[model samples]
Target: MPKHKEYTILLLSRVTLKAHEFITKVVQSNSAFGPCPEYICKCGNIQSDICETATVAISSVYHQVFKTKTKFSGLEVLGFDKTIITDELLSDLPFRPYNFQLGILRIWIVKIGCSNEITTNLAGPGFKSAFIYQYNKSRALFFQEIDKNHCRVTIYYECNAYIDFIEQNPDLVWSKIGILQKYNRNQLFELTNQYTTNLIQAAQIPYCTLNEWNNKEIITNIYNYHLKCCIIANINWYQFFCNKFEQPNTIIELRSALQLIYPIEHEIGERKFRAWKAMLKNVGCSDITPYEKDQSNVLNNLIRACMHLWTQRISY
Candidate 1:
């Protein structure tokens, strides 16, 4: 590996051997001046950013990075969404046993909203609902062409989403920090997903399935914990279905639809379905007994059971 020089470049990924060669021959020579130029390259005696040779060199390195399909590029394309983020993008990432991939997966799990709590007051208009307040953050890619065959690239990444949210919801103080983190994480994931989805479509794959995140085994205790979180966070499982399917007008209709999609046996005198009904009630699925601790327990139990059942049935 070539040693770091006195350039302002921030290396976000492992430098390849070719990159090392380009940097040594081109970057080192140009930036030898006391002050680092905005961009530099070794060939064509070009010292300014306007050099035609530099453009070609930068393009070459840019293509090489994408051709290797670095994790930075993959994440830039696929997104951090639980379903969209995949290992395919991690193929060229320069780290061993890439924990960054796992970090993205964990964020996806949190974005599931299983542990996200929202009071009536906390239900103020979401960022999506306020277009004027909405924005995205991304890394800016810069290419410094050194010569006809050489150039160096750099990235400027900034996370403005969290700060923006805090600015917009100042009254909430630090209470909105978690909300901002959740939203920003999902946004990054979604952006990556969009980028990858386009690539997959271009490649003409029948369909690109997400990574094996959903297939991760959830132990009994973990499942139980998620259940508690769901209740505490006021997660409305019914809302998940309602968003996908038609919104049911009543609890009976909602229950009927759930049963149709996810069949549950009503054992003789077991009142197995009763608990589910009670919990749904708390989540506004039913008009009766909304927010009862006993009903919550029953609901948690039902959700835990459903976790296993759904894992077996769902593919995506």
Candidate 2:
């Protein structure tokens, strides 16, 4: 393979190994706390905040090692969440793994929410009324993938749903942490494994055939057909739908709709969709609309029609 690819693989391996060691130490050191179920119960109920304990821990380590501020430290980076592992971030690391280039390893920090059933089971029916007992629980998953095919998932960190609960119920901190850690170590492993397996299966499926259409005329026909469906569905044509005209917002909405129709996984489909969008934007069509106005409700009927068409074409 290319030298850069080899270098990336080596760098990521080292980073993963170091990260594991650092997190393990942090968890082990902080795992001991006294118990107090009364204080935990006294906290009442509230929505669970996305626990930043793991993010903070990881960020602290990264900052110390790299001497650079990350998103967790007000770096203002856009990603899925605060604790994401991107290729750009991996490239910043200095270490290189020795003789480890079997395949490319990409690490992703995935946030998995606790199911209502599990939460209800844990807290019991009496505690179920509490908002904290609802869907407040979550776990941070360290998903490592090799060449997008082989994946290894592990629970990197666990946290109580309500941060205040941990604070007020200081004695029960270890118990609370232990609950999630134990559950995640056992039950959640199977859940994440199954989820990862499903993703792998989905990825193995061929890209939708709708993306193969290259003829502009056929594409335009499809667009018009959807427009007609929108009109038939009583969508306000002048107020909502974009036609062959100078409607920038409408064009943007149309592009978004196309994304839902042909997702990013469909590489050729995305290219074709963009090309189609550009064509509609620059080279205005006289055949579709009599006049143009501000775009609104562009998604309503258009989405319905597109989804209908998509469902007919693609099979899971």
Candidate 3:
């Protein structure tokens, strides 16, 4: 049995003093409330126990924070919305299993109106710039304040399952073989390039000229396209290797071949022409065996296909 993963989001908001006061009253009133039965069942939890515990903890923190002082340094007030296990969030996850019997579930714990020391850390000039750089590198979703004092910050925590169902179950071999036969190298590359070009064109506007809505959509598209490209590349590589090794029918044979020549290494300064040269290297050499020569040919072709798609920068 594999351990279940938990995903969490902490949202921070800054509101007017009056608005904050009103929100505090509302949270206090619903201090003992739990998520409804529908949500509990949908989330696949046992009788809403986890949801109720989270709600109680959030309410307790809110009560403690608002009991004495009105002004706090960082995000001090907090509230829990609901534990959602919807298909929307699941579709956004990095991994989408195909033809495998692996169970991949995501439980989203969204905490609204939360406060932490991160706000205070962001106040420093150096930390602010560094944080922005890190945020951009992460490519996570970004939100801004609706008004003057209202802002939302969301943080996600994801856990991945480690069970190797592919090895445990031999019945899924046909499914993997089917995936390999579904797309060839050329077809995969063509589709990936077309999709990437569309995404690049849609985001061609100047960053400074983009409005809030446009910016959000562009960012989301960028992330989604990146994930799509990765998935396509993985499938393409699997198919490439399976074909390169003469289409191994059994899982054991496929696994052995992959273990021997799974990762095609690329040097930092290596040129595309150099890979071509290696592929055309004579098999008479004592250093390179016939098998190694064939591997080089496959590697050269794969690199050429990927480079051709990746270098295309279509402009509007």
Put down candidate 3 lDDT per residue, 157-232, tens digits, no spaces.
Answer: 2222111112111123213323223433222112123432343343232222112223445434433433233332
lDDT for 156 in candidate 1 is 30
Candidate 3 regions with alpha-carbon error over 4 angstroms? 1-12, 15-60, 63-179, 186-194, 200-316
RMSD of each: 22.3, 22.5, 27.0
lDDT, residue 173, model 1: 25
TM-score of each: 0.16, 0.16, 0.16
Which is the winner by lDDT between candidate 1 and candidate 3?
1
Instruction: For residues 224-289, write the lDDT of model 1, one tens digit per residue.
Output: 332343332433343433442232222243344344544257221224344444333323222333
In candidate 3, where is summed lDDT lowest over 10 consecutive residues?
124-133
**Model 1 poorest 10 in a row by lDDT:** 107-116
Best by lDDT: 2
